[model samples]
Target: MASFVMKQMVGGKLNEMKGGLDSLTGGNEGEGEKTETGEDPEVVAARLEQEERRKDKHRKMEQEREKMRQGIRDKYNIQKKDESGGMGGFDMADGRIGAARKKTPEELAAEMHAEDDSLVGQLGLTEHVEKAKTAVNGAFEMVKGFLPFGK
Candidate 1:
């Protein structure tokens, strides 16, 4: 889903670039710069496309953040939409909630460690994702090994 949104954003930007290039070349680029409302055609299209891309990016970020928030809530046995309301934003942060609830550092540490073990065991990730993660991580480490810091 995120990838689809990203692709849409990239495609939209490419189209906008092409439009701008054609506009720069000549006023005879078919659409000219006149709108039905007597407004600038190029400006209207550019504005509309920018708005669409902005909305798309916002929706994508919300979805990705919600997924992460729900994952954390699941680990801590919390509700997705409890009586207090949806904790989709910063209110569900681990450190903030931990402090408010009086969870000690050592206790939080243990919980985090246990959560890590269960997460890898129960995430239900596909074999393809696991393989891709391995490949990506290996690539990352290979680059890191060649860093100027001489690790």
Candidate 2:
């Protein structure tokens, strides 16, 4: 009984699909009606011309927008991605093109160390840090001299 109901449902669906396919194939229906390919040549030409004009108007608008963007960039000294060459417009102080390619672990570590050194130098703490290290070393030596354990 279930199989019979399923067969009925499938038969109904097949009929609907056949009807749809017949309409799409223009089979024996609307034989006198004008299809797109059967339309007048002048109408097709005017449609194509209108489409070209619309496309040209959009192109002009896009050009105007680009000009405005360029003017703003020039006024504020902004750089485009292509103009900056993927470096995001920031140049390394050491004149290295760091962003041109991927960096190894060693290279990344060296860059971090250099950045730390530069930050210390910029803050005027390099000399103070050096003096502190010297003082600590001297104190350690004095304590070692008084102790007889290592002798």
Candidate 3:
């Protein structure tokens, strides 16, 4: 009984080692184990061809869109920016023309202030507001000058 158990254990270990070695050597075990979907090779090729055709169709549509955009630009006499260099209206990365760049904080603040000033001007209080701002600034400067520590 002991000899039989030892033989079985040794046989199992040998079989495991053989499988490992076969795998390391790129054995044909994978080929035989592959599950076939029963689809014909010709059908697979047709599917791939169809996918290629769909991709081509999308590419052509995108090209047509670009052509339409170009036609509109030509009508308006707008030149597209060169991809290499120049600050023209076209965005090189996205291929979009006249794309607005993001404004910095200072720019946003300046725009807000300009809008406020325009609103104030529309209300006919521009001169009065300017005079008030000047008076306040002059008062601030006069006080600053009187402070000896600032000098």
Each prediction's TM-score versus the true structure = 0.32, 0.32, 0.31
lDDT of 2 by residue, 70-118 (tens): 9999999997658445466455655686644557799898985676568
**What are the per-residue Cα lDDT tens digits for candidate 1 across 36-104?**
887777778899999999999999999999999989998999865664642433345565652344467
**What overall lDDT goes with each candidate model?**
0.77, 0.82, 0.81
Q: Rank the candidates by lDDT, best first.
A: 2, 3, 1
Query: Residue 24 error for model 1, in Å?
Result: 13
Stretches of model 1 off by over 4 angstroms after superposition: 1-33, 36-38, 82-151
Clashing pairs in 2: none
Root-mean-square deviation per candidate: 23.0, 15.2, 13.5
Per-residue C-alpha lDDT of model 3 across residues 31-99, encoded as one tens digit per residue = 544337656566778889999999999999999999999999999999887667645533445566566
* C-alpha positional error of residue 53 in candidate 3 after TM-score superposition, expressed in Å: 0.8
Deviating ranges (above 4 Å) for candidate 2: 1-36, 83-151
